[model samples]
Target: MATTAVINGERLWSALMAMAEIGRTPAGGVRRLALSDEDRRARDLLVEWLREAGCAVRVDDLGNIYGRRDGDDAGATAVVCGSHLDTVPTGGRFDGVLGVLAALEAVRAMRDADLRTRRPVEVVCWTNEEGVRFAPAMLASGVVCGRFTVDEAHAARDQDGRTFGEELRR
Candidate 1:
């Protein structure tokens, strides 16, 4: 016999719809540039939802958000999941957000099922993935993995002459 983990499709759809409304474009797409006010709201909502699902949340220096859910072992390598939350200036509803929301839904489903795995699980929301607003896409994840330096990323500027670090600090 195989056990199945059930997830609420309606809940996931609602969450996606809610996120889409934050930076909705005139053409029915999203325009959530990284470090923008709309992006901040979406980030806050993700943190709130993660908290409601009982995850320990933290935001890194480069603005990557991590939500960890503990499993049987206390000191184990986590099974990481998730993707960037930021989208291009006029991106579709599911562009990068679906991966983030799917990870959240997985955590929610695990919580609902009371399932326990051997290793911990963590969901990460990477920052500044779309280069439309900030130069050099995948900045946060690259900085973490040593592919790019923090100083390099911080110095990156937008079309409006605002630095990545400046927007991050705002």
Candidate 2:
């Protein structure tokens, strides 16, 4: 899709609403816990939209998703922008969701306008950001940024004894 036809406020709002619809609580909060079906669905939906906008998408072992726009130089670091898709058990609508969708919307707008930067742009979605399921927050980013080891993240368990590695598989 072209950048001009990409980022529409209506569409963005609709997408946000759609994500909110998953695991919606009576009080207008979302309960899509990390690695749950709802979380996976939301992640998949975002990746689908990213692909539609000509982004090359990849997910790290810990489920840190990256949607990249190809750049002239393959070696350039991406101008990445995004937050997390995972939400708390009683999470508000905006929170980190807006940050993730906004980055995607920006990419769509850029594509529609045929805009290009010296470095490629990436729309990212980090996993388990809220830590509602895994205890500590930013587990994925911690691993990705070298703040923590993959083994350490894998050892993380929820209140129910489920490990982060097992959750990522689901």
Query: Residue 60 deviation, candidate 1, in Å?
Result: 0.4
- Model 2, residue 18: C-alpha shift (Å): 1.2
Best of the candidates, TM-score: 1
RMSD of 1: 1.7
Give the clashing pairs for model 1: none
The 10-residue segment of model 2 with minimum total lDDT is: 1-10
lDDT of 2 by residue, 14-118 (tens): 889988887788999988888999889999999999999899999988998999998777789888899987887789987788999999998888887887666
TM-score per candidate, in order? 0.95, 0.93
Off by over 4 Å in 2: 1-7
